[model samples]
Target: MNVSIIVPVYNEAKTVERVLMELVAVASNDWEIIVVDDGSTDGTRSILQTVCQEIGVAVVFRDHNGGKTAAVKDGLELACGRWVIFQDADLEYDPRDIHRLLAHAETGHRVVYGKRRGSWHRPNRWVFALGVLGVDLSILLLFGRFVRDHATCYKLIPRSVLTSLQLRSVGFEGCVEITAKLMRSGIPISQIPIGYTPRAMSDGKKLTPAYGFRALGAALRWRNWRPCPSPAEHTGSSSTLPAKRANSALN
Candidate 1:
């Protein structure tokens, strides 16, 4: 497969169905879309029945509400794509950009993040802007590199590179985990500007000022850490993706 798209959902019942439909429309036969339900208290699980009927789509219902990181880890084990990307259950991100990310990967860019054009909305924009700025600036100071937008939800990573990142974090902090580890690994991140329709807090937007602080903490804690060697790295087996393996060489 070319890319595996993992959709991590909590209680996003309103938008989850539409998101899955958009993904199914955008995905080619070679792509696999894995929808992970993080023990939704809402009727999201029922909505995912639509996903089961769609081809190239699969759903995994977690036992409990384990945040984005844990849900992704669960889906990653089943990924067979050369590259992997995360799609939030909300409507903030565009699904058509999946092809844009894949084109970048075809050009051999191992790590790519979709650059948001800008934030739009009222007081909600202020909240989001401040939190993103705080987390981004903190990571830049700690890692000596400006990542453009570490808080962008449209990060595209090679499956091999992702496996070697030793990613660990829950909720929004997972973004910080990926950014810090990649900076420490000396990987260059290429950003492509895209559109975003920012949502308000009342619209079920989960990120908050506390998430920003936790993200900064995650970045500080993970900085300078190296990825532990997987069995394939030691044995030189070079197994398929979702299998234990070392990182792929970047362009």
Candidate 2:
């Protein structure tokens, strides 16, 4: 099946090129790579444009920064493929795992999250772990889904499943919201073990402990608050969208 990889980036000038090169090297099947620039103030946008032009990849440049969630949502809407997967601009996650994800795409699983297995000595590891634990328990209690990893960006989702998702959060909370919504909708999900290289805060990694708390809270609230259809609902019926609601703090 054709694959559509949506990579939402912000100020990733240092690692974007290598990530793109890895994708080109490992991804042999028919695929479309969509790089969404989330209002990057640095030369990230220019670099993305140049790389996409050279690699013949698709590009979606947003004028204003809407955070990772908004950028990813936009890219998914424009994607035309049987399978869609999310990739981070940083090379933390390996591109070679794409094939492992696709191998399970035909098994009726709607979403596949790359579960990172590593020792906890990294910075903010405790807070992120606790937040993930809280969020996971909340999901089980509210949605009856037990996901090993709740906020993983390396998620492979079928186009049909992506269409059914109704998301609006523009931050890390987006990942929690999507997980909760998909599980609530009775979509099958799987967690696969993958390699992860944690980056330090000084390395331009923006997901901080504050964002982790915000994400955990969002997961809990999203379990109860039903999301409305986004404006992109009319684009296709395969998406099976919900109604839109203003960006709620809890959502």
* TM-scores of the candidates in the order shown: 0.88, 0.85
What's model 2's overall lDDT? 0.75
Q: Which stretches in model 1 have alpha-carbon errors above 4 Å? A: 54-56, 229-251
Report model 2's TM-score to 2 decimal places.
0.85
Best by TM-score: 1
Worst 10 residues of 1 by lDDT: 242-251
Q: Candidate 2 on 130-154: residue-level lDDT in tens?
A: 8777777777877876987777778
Give candidate 1's error at residue 223 in angstroms.
1.4
Model 1, range 1-251, lDDT digits (tens) per residue? 77788888999999998888888888887777777788988888777755444443567777699888888988887777777899998999999997897797569676899988755656768777877887888888888888777888898987777788866776778898998888777778888887787888899887777887788789879977876653332212222443222111100
Candidate 1 vs. true structure, TM-score: 0.88
List candidate 2 segments past 4 Å from native.
225-251
